[model samples]
Target: MSTDFTDARLLDALGTLASTAGAAIMAHYGGASSIKSDGSPVTAADHAAEQVILAGLAGLLPEVPVLAEEAAAAGRWPASTRMLVAVDPLDGTREFISQNGEFTVNIGLIADGRPVAGVVFAPALSRLWLGAGSKAEAMELPPGAPISAATRRRTIRTRPLPAGGPVALVSRSHPDAATSAYYAGRGIGEQRPVGSSLKYTLIAEGEADVSARFASITEWDIAAAHAVLAAAGGEMTQPDGAPLVYGRAERQFRTDHFIACSGAYAAAGRR
Candidate 1:
């Protein structure tokens, strides 16, 4: 917890690392491979991108520990956290390998087991989203190279959900038949096929109405976006309507599916 590393400073650093990581990922795009604990493909890009972000985070916040995706998958989790950085340095590696370019770099800071700040960067698309808990602004910055990212910052916010016919952004990569059925069950109109954590960001910006994830997912996948979505006037919650929570025991991470929707939806539902 370096007081010197404010949310703005961390996001700026995250932007720089994301650019470097994205570039590293590009080099190994379709040709990368590493074995996961379960023998799934980890990819060279995952390690390369993670290492770059991890080192940068360490340098920027010398007292903090990072619980990055690549590192956690490798059995390197952090302990005793007043502040923790969650990094999905290359989300959507499968999409990246398939060349769909829907991947992103996710960074989140948790205090007392809840996110206080976060950043998500989609490199190939050259887009970035970040938030500073309650004290600073949440924003979106367009794509730029790593070396030139420090100067670019743009503010962003969610518009109200439409009067009707709200758009639904679903998982382009992981939608199961049941998930599709769930959306259909909700009478959702105008579905957009998206990948990675971009689903929540879209909801935060009011481009989409809700996200119903009926399948399994990890905390690292959604926590960062959860922070931004909350700041942008949205909620990520379990289907039972429980508020989304993080930093539970390890088993909970894999089972934490959630739905994200506009602030109005909850109030409307209650009526």
Candidate 2:
């Protein structure tokens, strides 16, 4: 693994690549989607965006391999490496198909099972979030604005839980009983339904306090936002309280039931 994987300039380039992929995705949004053999939905936008991200990452970091959602689904997975990039060109395909405008393009760098840097771009929302080293920030891209052009850039951090209770974010399409049960007696102030990795950004930016998922999820689905949350002083861990680790062969990139929480939630959990 390269020691410079978390370099700010490199992460910025990755962010731009994510934005480019997001543009490609928006071109095909709300059209139609096809079912992959694995029973997941796919569209031209997924392929086109993955191609753009793959090419851009190859040019920027030839030494690292990319494990992208569409490519992996097609059996194009590369050999496991300690350092690689995880790309979810268009996350929340169902949301896209339903025209909810909640999908996003994600690009993440993982080193030794830990995410080091990442970018998440919601093209329809004209928003972008990035994490590099110890810094996490968000930007508001104007309508038709280039990726490099943002009307505002702001540093983001997780806030302490309120005295009343913490707010929880749940998957809009895959809400499971387990998630609700987990917070049933914990006194969660509110539960919001959100799509894609944006849930992590919500917590990282302190818009929400925590997210718990009992359903299966892949590394690509959460790695990018995981980096952003971690940079913003949050954490993601299995229900048993172990930190979620990526690049696992036995599990095949599938994560177990886990919780992504702000510092406040994490501290409370330990009590």
Candidate 3:
């Protein structure tokens, strides 16, 4: 909670918390799911994982307020504050129900409308990523292993766009016609379809060069991975090229259209 905490320490805490939540989510994997009031599907895994993450965050940083998906959907939100945690215990619920192994547990810290730290854990894939400040890393979490015990962490960064072309990552669930038209107009290379915030992480890890979102989305959907991408030397901004700001009171945390890109792709957009 204190600014004095180094990025490494914050990421470590977040990784641990996210790993715990991932375990909770896996417990309900492959089970029946119910629809929430908003028409989005919800499973016991979502609630159970949220509970684990919330408790873990409270224990790790009691001073920091938490805004979690389940709680927020129930009309529960923390008071207006610059510094707080945003969590999506089960992102990609449809993927989970379909057993596609793309869902993730996301936890992020937002300060002054910017994501400063975050952790994204995909239990189904046993992959975890952490980011804070200007640093980011990826590691594998063996089945039932705690994140604190994860070894072989590799520092991650975005690669420059190739001379031939740039690869784009797009949403699997909500592909937009405008996004496709934008890519075509920009002469983008291959496009990859992925679920959840993993698209952002793929770009951060240099697996893809850019991601453009046009559909309706909430802060919790992207904040954590946005932090990781930013920390990995990538950038996320509005289509008009302004930096994305979080913690909107009027919009109830919804996000506008934005593009997340590596430096090379960002430069290409400028051109």
Candidate 4:
């Protein structure tokens, strides 16, 4: 078994595992959803996908502890946090319930409170993005496609802020007045309301420039794509410019509001 999370073979396997979870999610998609104890919408898809991912991870990296969204929600968490796997089997449940193509399955490897490797797969769109160390890439993998099918992938990197100005990305379902004011204050007129971790992948791929949230979010919600963005030469930091850390079991893995920006935007102190 490969203990190196950044190994290309491991990354490929992780991507395949996520795609399998995506298939599970699609099986339950469009079906009725129920409210979790936290009042968040959940469907069979969420549980189904989580099962697939957890089982796969146990075989792939048995030594690493997994902190998964559904498990954490049930007050189950790994005792150790030194090295952890953050999993959000189905991110954007709302988008998933709404039947949009923006939902994703995320798996991130966190060590020393920093995400070192991660994969984000959007089954509906047949797109997958991954990152490790200082490298990131994206490819198309249909619902049941194997990792071997990811033969045509593009290496992705963040670009400098466009001359026209940074293109901002916001949540499609969680709009707020504070975010509106933040954009307006920066004279950011070009904004796209994206769903799930797609916003981070966009910034990592140079299709977008920045994204900010004024509300606290759970770690699994962003860790995977955060790794991708970081690997692609971007950064995800608190609004105060501090690095965002993960594996906060005490805080229930909740994170403060963060601003994600391309490398150039962060370099220019625009974050």
TM-score of each: 0.86, 0.95, 0.95, 0.97
lDDT of 2 by residue, 9-90 (tens): 7776777788788888888877778899988889998999999989988789887878889888877775865887888999
Window of ten residues with lowest summed lDDT in model 1: 135-144
Best by lDDT: 4
Q: What is the C-alpha RMSD of each candidate to the true structure, in Å?
A: 3.0, 1.9, 1.5, 1.0
lDDT of 4 by residue, 41-85 (tens): 989999999999999999999988999999988889989988999
Candidates sorted on TM-score, descending:
4, 3, 2, 1
TM-score of 1: 0.86
Cα lDDT for residue 188, candidate 3: 79
lDDT of 3 by residue, 47-146 (tens): 9999988887777778877778999989999887587788899999999999999889898888889888888999999899998778889999853577
**Cand. 3 TM to true fold:** 0.95
lDDT of 1: 0.70
Instruction: Give the Å error, residue 249, model 4.
Output: 1.2
- Model 4 TM-score, all chains together: 0.97
lDDT, model 1, position 91: 81
Local distance difference test, per candidate? 0.70, 0.85, 0.85, 0.91
- Using TM-score as the measure, the top candidate is 4
Decoy 2 TM-score against native = 0.95
Regions of candidate 4 where Cα sits further than 4 Å from its true position:
none
Candidate 1: segments with Cα more than 4 A from true spot: 1-6, 134-153
